[model samples]
Target: MHRVIAKLAGLTLLMLSALPSRAEEARQFRLSVPAEVAESGLMDYLLPRFALKTSRRAELVGGGAADAVISADPQAGTAVMARAGTVYALRLTGENAAARRFADWLSSDVGQRTIAAFEPEQGAPFAAARQQQAGPAPALDGDPALGREVALRHCARCHRTHDDDRSSGIGSTPSFPALRALPDWADRFTAFYVLNPHPAFLRVEGISPPFDPTRPPAIIPVELTLEEAEALMAYAASVAPADLGAEIVHQ
Candidate 1:
């Protein structure tokens, strides 16, 4: 009777050890993006592709503009999330072990394949159509002049063109600091802005459009096309502050 009772207790301990705890089961994560990007009808196109690719290992939950869903459960592997613009941001979240596994998976061949599969059908392709509709192409003869012209035409309204002596004006200037930090920053910045000209950060900063509907109206219909954005980035790069090199160090 003693031997049988001891065996039964050992079995109970083994079963309990295999069971997951409550904390492990209730993990959650939140991700946010610009509302305009969500409303622009791109998230719908991107979400399913991301989910299908990731669902085998992770549970893809809520997704929309400004916020997304990802599970924190150890069993639910890592989740990847992104927000749009020339300077896009992406994040991954999960338990330590699962997150590490997901990171390895993302860096692997299978992960690359999954990312490659995400087709922004309505975003990039639509932008190309709009570009075609716009009349004769401006001669991009590897000249900063073309960049300046593009900038003056599209971006001058929101940003400063020339260098200002006043510190106050400089503080308010929305310059392309990133371009000046990188090698060939001019060409890369121009290309990026020309491809996507939307002021994603401006909206968040309450400088363009107030995202909250409850707040008093500020700006209306805050969005921009890739071409318009590209023009702005290119122009900013052309006239970026000389001290941009120092900013990169801090970054």
Candidate 2:
């Protein structure tokens, strides 16, 4: 009888302790941002549009307890406050789907116009492109030789482009042949500028480096047009993979 009563009491305490957590779960859909953004009325302007698009209400939490963070680019100067794009929070649970919807809406044409109108100078009016349907990946088409020319002009400073090309690029940079070797090489050209070697070596963004007037900068950012990017990808696809040397002899 005593054991049964003790078990009942413990269960009651457990249920009591869970109440606050359950309450928190009920009111979730919260986003986190810096105290400055929250206090400065940015959220006030953004949240209403957000609610309209997602058909959900979201509470903004200050001191960085948000599901998403809206902050200034660390590299951007005060004069031109470059928009660094949104950083959405990662939560694997299904409950956070509302956050995804909010993000999609922000990138949508309607959201772009609203954002542009909000800050005329910085936020240029955005017209969202039609969303592509999910299906088998489409084939990449471009002129490989033209791509090679673009690469030689822009990437050769750090990357070896061809077999006979004698000058090795930066120590860390892999040769074009080597990069093409990877199965995921296509991704390298998809958003090349935003990714690795480009981010670190090329396009450093914001203030341009002061250099000697006589000589060109050793490594300037490569800003490719749509045709150029496609060409580069085509050329990358054409290249033979680099031989990474003999397989490791495991003990």
Candidate 3:
């Protein structure tokens, strides 16, 4: 067990030495791969590219003490990626930031393209599993009326709730309509409580942990029940998106 850890650590240092520029800031994690993958030199081919793009490094290791794993079948943890049929895919064991970034890159179009491009001396390149057509997401469950009330009491201080709500909310911050216009509006609304500015002063009862006493909120805390937070999302979803036209090209 100690020998395996030492081997991975030594390899990590060697890899870091090759990239002196990012070595200091690099986040290193272990990724356990099947023997086939290791023998194929996929990590040797993929890791350098991933590290160059993300500045995070993975030290290839065997089973145990790994932050992530490459598997043909995942029994647990987040399934990151896999190829069609015979051996494929990387899986995460936890919410490691570096691991997530690696997963993101692996799932990205570039990542898929890179995977398809890799050709071992003796075998065919791995291909992505065929994805099924996804249907529209269901509308979030909550009371829009109550959500509006919550928004007016809390969010309205920073965001314009309606087109006519110019008198309220800070000018620098975006309006609800404008935010709803964004591509990731749903993600933004649903996870806003964890996003910046909100975390400092906002709390969702039974969901968010209590604020640290040593670093108390800058302003009087604004607390909400989980129901209120869900309702706020419902209201935001109901808002009409502002018309943000085509991108301006600088030719």
Question: Considering every candidate listed, which one attains the maximal TM-score?
Answer: 3
| Residue lDDT tens for model 3, 179-206 | 9987767766765665455656787776
Q: For candidate 1, what's the RMSD?
A: 14.5
lDDT of 3: 0.71
Which digits, one per residue and each the tens of the lDDT, describe model 2 over residues 132-227?
Answer: 111122235689889889889987878888777877577688888887775557655444543322433333223212222553435654555556
RMSD of each: 14.5, 17.4, 14.5
Please give the ranking of all candidate structures by TM-score, highest first, separated by commas: 3, 2, 1
lDDT of predicted model 2: 0.53
TM-score on alpha carbons, each prediction = 0.31, 0.41, 0.51
> In candidate 1, residue 130 scores what lDDT?
11
Q: Pick the winner on TM-score between candidates 1 and 3.
A: 3
Q: Which stretches of candidate 1 lie over 4 Å from their true place?
A: 1-6, 14-97, 100-154, 164-184, 187-251
Between candidates 1 and 2, the one scoring higher on lDDT is 2
What value does the lDDT take at residue 214 in candidate 3?
69
Judged by TM-score relative to the true structure, which candidate is superior, 2 or 3?
A: 3
